[model samples]
Target: MRIIIAGAGDVGFHLAKLLAYEAHDINIIDMDDDRLQYISNHLDVHTTKGNSTSYRVLEEAQISKADLLIAVTESETTNISTSIIGKHLGAKKTIARVSNTEYIQRKDILDLKDIGIDEVISPESLAAKEIKRLLKESALTDTFDFEKGVLSLVGISIDEESELKDKTLVETAYLNPEYSFITVAILRGEETIIPHGDNKFMLNDHAYFICQPNGVERVLDLAGKQRESIKNLMILGGSKIGIQAARQLSKKYNIKLIEQDRDKCFELADTLPNTMIINGDGRDVELLKEEGIDDMDAFIAVTGNSETNMISSLVAKNHNVPKTISLVENMDYIHLSQNIGVDTMINKKLIAASFIFRYIRKGQVLNLTTIHGVDAEIVEFEVKEGSKILDAELRNLDFPQSALIGGVIRGGKGITARGNFMFEPKDRVVVLSKPECIRKVESYFK
Candidate 1:
């Protein structure tokens, strides 16, 4: 596909990298000549150094023939203007990255899509929602639900007490005749393995499994993980993400927000009436303790500084907080965070990039999400007539060995498919696959 991405920031750059690896015709535009040069030198993409808002720059990037135009500059105004202008310039689809929470919540009042923007993505809000999900399921490192709550792809660190620990996949398969769930992937020290029969699960290894709804308790039971309910949450940042998270989850859980800046603390106090806003450094352990950190059910650190966020989250975990989540800007720290004990480390840029990547891919992909620190994706695609997926039963199809069909939604009901089950048109199927197998898996739905 011919794609033009405006802004060489983290989101745009990451999107370009993902698409370029798939052999797409990618063109990146940015005002910073240095960033454009950096991307051009490292990635196999055409870089255009100029203002993306200019008609001349869009024309120069061949936007008229572009299949997708993505505006992800830091400035919301620039992204909005670029998407609107790019759509008018003949881009097949346009997406704009926005920071304004209002644009997303009040979409009916001010429809950005009506003005030519096909989609509006909010990274901060996405990160916040991820943190909320992590808190709700504190035992699991990651959880992705498909077809509402019918099926889920859940990740858990293998504890020493787990029954499956030190057991090979073949042994476990015989031990449980019910076959309640499917073991999809395993993350060892630094490598992610698409497990087979001979693979033995080790202690401290991160394991991802696909199971039907209400299988969470069973999965946790087999993994020897005790479920914990989140009651009290302490938010360490008063940024947009912090405030938005507090706003969304405060209704169900007791929320306490701490901001280092006095002005930001007051702003949060005025904006969020239910949350308790305090002026204190998140790095200060004494301050956290004074605010009943030990008594809290969950602690979330989402400050701008990645290092501070990581350290503060570690401190909260050390303080015996049941769950700890950190917002890390640098995607590199995500893997390490899991090993060190943080429940989940979220990256907004990656979330937005994956959101846009799903749009560029052909087929009836209803939704797509990447697990934190994991190199795999949870893709939801609809079965349509003339699609190759409907020709035979799932097990008989030439499906990628590294990927598995997790669940299917038919007529608003969720079904865990067996080998003999055949897909019907309009059935929503969820597949879990590694990054390398995404294209191959997408081809089935095409």
Candidate 2:
């Protein structure tokens, strides 16, 4: 696909890198020469330095022949205008990134689709939704529901006390006699491992599993983690992401928000009637304890500064808080999730890029999800008639070594993919694949 990106910022660069890996023709446009130069130095995509809203610049980037145009230039107005104009310039599809929740929530009144933006995404809103989902299963490092709750992918760090720490998958078979879930992937320090029966999970390894509806708890047990229900919550910062999370999660949990700006605190108090707003520094350890950090079920740090968020979360962890989630703006900080002792580190731009990438691939995929901080993707493919996959059992398919069929949803029922299982036409097959071999994995489904 020939794609044109309207920004060379984090989100646009990430989307370009993902598309570039697939050997797509990608051209990035931005006003900053340094950003475009950095993108050109690292990625194989072409870069054009200019305002994307300008028709001449769009023409220079060859937008008329572009399959997709993405606008994520940090300015909401610029993104919307660029997408609209890009669509008029003959781009097949356009996606706009926005910071205002109003654009996403009031889409019907805005008519963004009619104006030529085929899709719109708000990173702040998406991050808030992710925080709510992560809190549902507070014990796990990450929890993602697929196909509405029929399938789940859970990640947990292997600790010193984890039952599966030293045992290989074959030896740990007794731990899951019912086969409710399958070990899909493992994230060691810098490598993403596609697990086999002989793969042994080491301490500190982040293990991922694909489970049935009731398999989440089983996976929790296998990891030696006790389930805990979240009630009291604490959030740092009054930024859009922090405020949005408090607004959404306040209905079920007691919320206390801290903001360094006193005026912002008062505004937050007025905006969120249910949440308590405090004017204090989140980096102050004494303030955190005074505000009852020990009793808090979860600590969320979404401060504007990534350093403050990480340090505040570390302080909460030192206080024995059950869960600590930090909003990391730097893409490089995501890999330090557990290594730095924080439970979860999220980058909204990374999440937004992955979401848009999935939407772009909707034609070839039933569903696709990129696990945060993991170098693999879980993709759902609908098996078509006359596909080679339907002719033989899974074990005989000679599947890519870097990929694994995690589960299959057949006739609306979720089933764990076993070695002897044969796929049927129209079945939704879920596969976990590394980037290096994802294209080969997609071939079998095609």
Candidate 3:
């Protein structure tokens, strides 16, 4: 696919990296010469340093031949203008990143799609939704809903007291007996294991599994966690992400939001009717206690400073809050988020990148998700009669060791298959593999 990206920031760079791995013809446009040079040096993509909204720059990037154009520049106006021009200039599909939450929430009013933008994504809003989901569930470290929550992939961190710790995959399944969910990926340190029968889960490892609606609780139970309904949530910071999450979750959960700036607090109060906005420093532990942090079911920290967020989240945990979620913009902090006792750490840039990547792979991929901090992807592929995978049973195939067939979705049912399970035509096979092996695995299905 020939794709043109109009941004050289974190989200754009990440998207380029992901698409370049799939051997897509990519062209990136940005005004920053340093950023353009950085992207050019790092990625195997053509770079044009200029304003993407300008016709001459778009022409230089050859936007007319682009299969997809993603406008994710820092400015919302620039993104919208770039997408609109790119679509008019002949890009097949166009996506824009808008900063205003109103445009995304009131999509029926603005109708960006009518103006040539196929999709609009707000990283702040996307990250907010993720935080809301994490707080509501309060059991799993991460959750990805597929097919409108019919099928969910959840990640749970196994504690020292977990019942399934030190047990092999086959043994755990045998003990459970019902076989409700499929264990897809295990994150141990820096390694992600697509579990085999012999694969044993260790303490402090974060494991992800795919299951139906009723299986989420069962999976949590296996990891020694019980579902706790979140009633009250205390949020620190009045940043965009903080305000967005509080506004969305306030309708369902009792919310108390704190901001150091008096003006931002007033703005939040006006924006969020159901939420209580306080003008105070969120780093003050005394203020948190006074605001009833101890009685809160969940505490979310999304302040500008990472250290402040981490420390406040720790304080909330120390105050006996059942769940704590913090936002970490730094990619390096993702691994430590789970290990250091914070329930979940979210990055808006990464979430936006994942969402866009899934859209780009829509036709060939039934579904695709990347686990945070895990160097692997869980991709679902539909088997065709002409595909190499349909030639024989799984036992006869020389499948890559890095990839594992997690399950097969056939006839509206999920089945965990062994090496002897035959791959019939139209079977939707779910595979878990490192990013490096995705090409090898996709070739079999293609």
Candidate 4:
């Protein structure tokens, strides 16, 4: 595929890196020569130094023959303009990264698609949704429901108390006697492992699973965690993510929002009537304690500063908060979340990049999502007629060993799939594939 990404920022860089794994012809445009140079040196992508909004730069990047154009610059105006102009210049599809929720909320009335932008993504909104998902269960490091509830992908950190700790998948197979769940990948330190029967569940390993909706409790049990309800919540930072998260989560939980800016706190009070807005420095341990931090069920730190967010979350952990979620913008710090005791460290750029990547993906892909800090993607694919996947039993299909089929939604019901299972046309299959073999796995469904 020929693709053009109009930014060298976090989202653009991550998207380009992901596309490089598929061996796509990628062209990146940005004015920052240093960022472009960094990406060019590490990734197999072409870089051009210029303004994405400039028609000359778009033409120079061969936008007319591009299969996809993604505008993700820091400026929302630039992103919208570039997407529209690129689409007019003959790019097959265009996506614009936006910061305003109104653009997405009112897209139906605005008809952005008719104006050439095929899709609009909001990092703040995406990050807010991620925070809400993480709060579903205090113990889960990460969780996402697929197809509205047919299947779920859950991640947990293995500790000394975990029954499966130090045991191989073969030994733990009895825990899932109903054949309802499967381990997809393990994130150990900086390495990502697509586990097999012999792969042992080591201490501190971040294990990921895919199971039917009915199997979530069992998956949690296997990870040595019990389900817990979250009733009280605290949000630090008055950034867009914090505000949006407060708005979304306030409907379900009692919320206390803290912002250092007095003016922002007043604005939040007016905007979120049900939420208690306090004007104070969230980083001040005394201030947090004064606000009843010890009584809170969950603590979320989403300040603009990654270091501050991590520190606040750690402080909350020290206070015995059951769930602590911190937002870390630095991609390098993602792997250190569990090791440092933060339940989940989120990167909005990565979440947006993954969503956009799914949008531009080829074939019968129904949905595609990536776990925070994990080097694999969980994709839902439709089995097309006459596809190679339906020709034989799963064990004999020679499916990429790095990819695992977790579950299948067939005949309006979801089932945990096994090696003896045979696929049928129109079945929606969920799979976890590492970057190295993503394209190879997609080929089987084509």
Predicted structure with the largest lDDT when compared to the true one: 4
Best-first order by lDDT: 4, 2, 1, 3
Compare the candidates by TM-score and give the number of the best one. 2
Candidate 2: Cα lDDT at 435: 70
- lDDT, candidate 1, at 20: 78
Give the poorly placed runs of model 1, Cα more than 4 Å off: 21-23, 32-34, 41-43, 106-109, 113-116, 361-363, 384-396, 408-427
Error of 2 at 333 (Å): 1.4
Per-residue lDDT of candidate 3, residues 117-185 (tens digit): 999999899889778777657777878776565567788988877888999987887755666677888
Each prediction's TM-score against the native? 0.90, 0.96, 0.90, 0.95
lDDT of 1 by residue, 1-446 (tens): 89999999889888997787678899999999889888988899999989999999999999999999999999999999999999998999998899987899998798877899988889999888877777768788888877667778888888888999999998887645665577878888668787778999998888988777656777898888788888899999998899889999989999999999998787788899999998999898999999999999888998999889889999998998878888889767878877787777888898889878877764546888777766677888988799899999887997898887877889887776767889999898888788767779988887
Kindly give the number of clashing pairs for every candidate.
Answer: 0, 0, 0, 0
Clashing pairs in 2: none
Model 2: residues >4 Å from true position, as ranges? none
lDDT by residue (1-446, candidate 4, tens digit) is 89999999999998998889989999999999899999989899999999998999999999999999999999999999999999999999999999999999986689799999998999999999989888988988888887777788888889888988999999999888887788899999989998999999999888998878768888787777888789999999989999999999998999999999998888888999989999999989999999999999899999999989999999999999989999999878888876788888899999899888877774448888888888888888999998899889989999998888888999878888888999999999999998778889989888
lDDT of each: 0.86, 0.89, 0.85, 0.90
Q: Residue 279: error of model 1 in Å? A: 1.7
